[model samples]
Target chain A: MRNLPSSEAGAGPETVDATRRTLLQTGLFGSLLLGAAGATATLSGCTGRTEATAAGYKFLRDADLPFLRALLPGVLGSLLPAAGMERDRLLDDLLHRIDLSGYRLGLPSQKALAQLFDLLNMRLTRRLMAGIGPWEESTPAQVQAFLERWRGSSFAVLNTGYRALIKLVAGSFYGTPAGWAAANYPGPPPGPYQVFNS
Target chain B: MAIDDIYTKGIADGWKVVDASTLKQDQTYEADVAIIGSGAGGGTAAEILSAAGLKVLILEEGPLQTAANFKDMNDARAYGELYQEGAGRATSDGAVAILQGRSVGGTTTVNWTSSFRTPPQTLQYWADTFALKGGGEADMAPWFAQMEERLGISPWAVPPNANNDALKRGADKLGWAAHVIPRNVRGCWNLGYCGLGCPTNAKQSMLVTTIPSALKNGAQLVHHVSVRKLQFSGGKVSGLSAEALGPDGVKRSGVNITVKARHYVLAGGAINNPALLLRSNAPDPHQRIGKRTCIHPVNLSLAMMPEKVEGYYGAPQSVYSDEYQWKHGATGPAGYKIEVAPMQPLLGSVIFGRYGEELKTGMAQLPNMQSMLALLRDGFDEQSPGGSVEIDDSGAPVLHYDFSDYMWDGFRRAYLSMAELQFAAGAKQVMPLHLDSRPYESWEQTRTAIGGLQYRKQRVPVFTAHLMGGCAMGEDEKLTVVDSDARFRHADNLSIIDGSIFPTSIGANPQLSIYGFACKNATKLAGVLKA
Candidate 1:
């Protein structure tokens, strides 16, 4: 059973590397086949904005990256590195993977995800739907409060939005090889993976 | 040693296999039978009909991924390429998650291998209530035996893995009706990677078994082709049109292909089959096309076991308990069958349904996390009439299923039963997969907590891998879409030969039920066509 929604959101590191990595590594989608993170990818590139024009990834807009940026760190604490280049690269990696997953979503689910993220992308809409966010300004505690409120609300739409965000972020964050060590899945099974992982 | 990929050699040996994505121009083909899927029912029927000297052609929307491609054993690759919508398909409202496969072998390529014959009670109910001719326990016995022997179906010979052992131990301790699940596999490594496609060709999935045999027997298999609609000429399907999908399996390449066959078989499983018919605007005088689509609507309970369950390391499912299934009798309020799920990280995390530190705490316990799901038997009564299937703007399938009070009662009971059994099997804590649920330390605590939990949509993470009905069989055309022989009542040349033909839920994993019934019906269809 899923854990009961706990109201306490005060347990994670607050150090956020607000630097948005410019290199939107396309390896997130490719890494899915290997079932591992692009451990080979590094945070070497300097700041320059690049659009995600890859095919099959059409959901997340550039403006939506900030919303995910603020929420992902709060939702995924130490699963991502606390602070540094490793943290920046992993966050960028997580966002790319999340974007890839968003585009692959079915139409109905895509609409739901788009609607939820759209609310998060706009300050006014975020205030109305999520009840306070200019994501960059909102503290992790505030974001946590917003998620908790929606998750616990009786309205089905809020619950739906919360589940969509949580599933996308958590699933993508943990799916990477960086997160596998924390989860204790000792890589792929030694038997057949030897042929490929080698 | 790497296992041999069967299709490559079979194709080299004069077997016809086409990747529609590679088609540079429009093409047309004719066959004695054009089957619109390559799953359990379609594969089984293909083998039988082709063996009977019928030229069979199988049209599949997904790509043909085999053991060679399955060597990675990656969930993302499997879900992205083999599953319906990157493994994120859900109910139209996004309340319930659906795990349906969309590869060459459809769900057979991705399902946990648990083979059971259609229950005697379910068969009897069909005969009594729906006036379904044949398919009784006695009638289907030989067909079941035939398929079982053909697919190497038998009780798992090895000892149950830790995950299954817990289920067995609990059911035994509780004196419940639990037993070893029979599996369709040969040379199984006990490697627990069946859901990611068997890299060793151990699982007797249709991809490795029936489909190959059918191909060898002169059947044509085409992958990456999504059939658009059946071209109706008054009462019969004169033609079928389809669009070719690209390598990604989602976008079409705009290469339209048409098929003409003496007989058309719709084996696209429950949801796809109904949506295909509905999209074509097929005649449904009684509106029985997409009605009563049964999904053994599942609700799960999680356990923190004393020992490392390693739930993902062996046969995903080898033990199941039917204690609560027949407790209220077949016709009473809905009953459920309990089974364990493989602890894939992403699947577990989603069901773990936590975030940040809360999610991490659960992730840290993955080795000890065990999940038990209840397959609720639906469609037997008015309160639990089951869901329906509709198409989206792009004609893609969308399912709409609402939980009933009867189903909720079944969910409450199933959760309590699972928690009790998990505790009996040495779980430290048991929790129903509900939004409001907390880890209860004891069976008594779980009983108290579960009784108070709401069985609403997102509140409980409901899912279904088993889909049935939607084009149910009956002797009366007014109450059913297909006749007892699974032939469409309105279209003389068309047949619905998959799980869609079942009038109600089978109360078990549906692979063998589909295989046996398709084997029997296709043989009959073969004989009739041969005459």
Candidate 2:
């Protein structure tokens, strides 16, 4: 763990490129992929290729789905439906919402998010950073542990990644009426105003 | 009873409203004055200039969403359609979330309707520090009153909902200076969905009032056109090149547009106005265009009230306290105003920032959640130099704001105050919106914990809905981008009539400040153009 104020020390002194490079070199990606000193080659290969998923998502490459799915139950907890078809449907809907939101982000933010996802999706980084091999085989406890690890990580990048994931999941889920209903919200109050759309 | 979507009637009555997204070929507009951005500033300017018998063109980047689109009162839909970046805008490093509006009416269409004049202390600070003139309390009172009367601005008469009432109750108990917030509305339904577009068309936003009036007075409005850059020569704006955005309002269509005007008004607000200037390579001999951008950086505290606060109903903000606002003066360490936020599920969950079972459990108490936010008044002290607006590789505006230790100290103090107030208002437990914070049952416990907590950026989530001060106005060209008359210092015939003209952060909600300044500056510009 490192020690420095995040806003001043972290935001300054390091460019986005520098941060990504440093994150890859010293951390989880380092031990996994860079043992052969192939970091630069691997890093260049990671960009621009996964901009879209084969499933026709504008963002959210196919590899990101399993990781997000594994984290959903832990992120939503009791909010997620019991392990059944209903839960699967809700998860799919939430992923769709998350995908739409991600696609709508500005170019810089989308670029940053893509890099974060790249780090998480790669086999080497996933094993080291998440402490798991494949998200499909990851248990809820493993997901929770990974989340806690990142949330408590000294690196601001990991914390930011954690925040982005949690916010996307929570905000997208809670934005729905079903989420509101489950949360005991009575929904928006009725008003006298109505609109007749032409 | 159905509320008439005014755009339909206005268009039927011969208003020249164009959806640029529908344009197939290149277009050119010739106007006496062209306003880029149709929010509080642009909308206000359009009405005044159009009324003065000048041909005015208003270009909006977002779609022309009306009451018809807002009737659903859905947060997700509203954020997607009406807000900037689908309400996903943040500081460059993702440390602070920015809630800015992008639609035709701009933020005024989606704001919580708290109309506050620029606080006297803030005005004095601007004058004393930035050498700003013609913007003192006395000089601005008439303009403020005129805009107030024009927009039906008055103290909200409705009873405070439980969420706002908690702040009032707490302030009253603590002997703090709290008051009912003024709102620019007519026959408001108190629906608490003002953050969505107002379905009742009663909020007196630019869409409902000034833009429609401008249209009535023969002004033309084109929506979904993004201004690319101003073509400038010899310290004067020549024309602007723009491209029509698609219906999704993200990608560009092939249809290009050019606007030629005798005068150009930049009212794109804070980060945007500065970014446009920077992108256009507008003359910046002093390099002051994008400097000093301030967002009233916000930190919030959540309280689980004993009573059902049900923050998602009634008027979103009807009460506020200014006890700490000017206590230490403007240039001191940082001071903040305390207000409450409506704890709708999505926003609440985002703020709470807990996960797993804790998230579900906390969310289940939605009806009882009362959120208090402190607008940490930045950009006054040397330490609080505020952010700068920089355009990314794609020419999109990105704000780089740093959280100084000075501001973090203010945040720590504000958290303590909010927790104390929540406890005074009989909250069961209060949690400062920090990743390390948990629910504290007592004010003393919260004070101790918050004091000891590490005040880091990612650890404590900060947010800003109020974007202010990028192209600041002052007498010194060395220090400011615009003059007191809102005229660009470097570019002749280019005026900025928006929140971007403030030399520092207004220690209050900035809608009224923008309205009053736009009214004053646009009137002067109209007079000059008429002559």
Per-model TM-score, in order, reads 0.91, 0.94
Q: Label model 1 with its docking quality class.
A: incorrect
lDDT of 1 by residue, B1-531 (tens): 566888878878888999998999999989999999989999999999999999999999889999888988876567667887777878776787888888889899999999999999999889888889987899999999999999999999899889889899998898988899999999888888888888888899899988999988989999999887897777999989888877777666878899999999999989889888887889999999888889998888889998898887889999999988887667897889999998877677777777878888888888888889999999888898888887654455768888978888888888988999999999999988888888889999899999888777788878899989999998977778998889898888999888998888999999999998998899999998899
Q: By TM-score, how accurate is candidate 2?
A: 0.94
Who wins the DockQ comparison? Answer: 2
Query: Model 1 residue A139 lDDT?
Result: 76
Q: Which stretches of candidate 1 lie over 4 Å from their true place?
A: A1-56, A195-198
lDDT of 2 at B400: 84
Query: Interface RMSD for every prediction, one decimal?
Result: 11.1, 7.5
Name the runs in model 2 displaced over 4 angstroms: A1-51, A191-198
For candidate 2, the docking band is acceptable
In lDDT terms, how accurate is model 2?
0.84
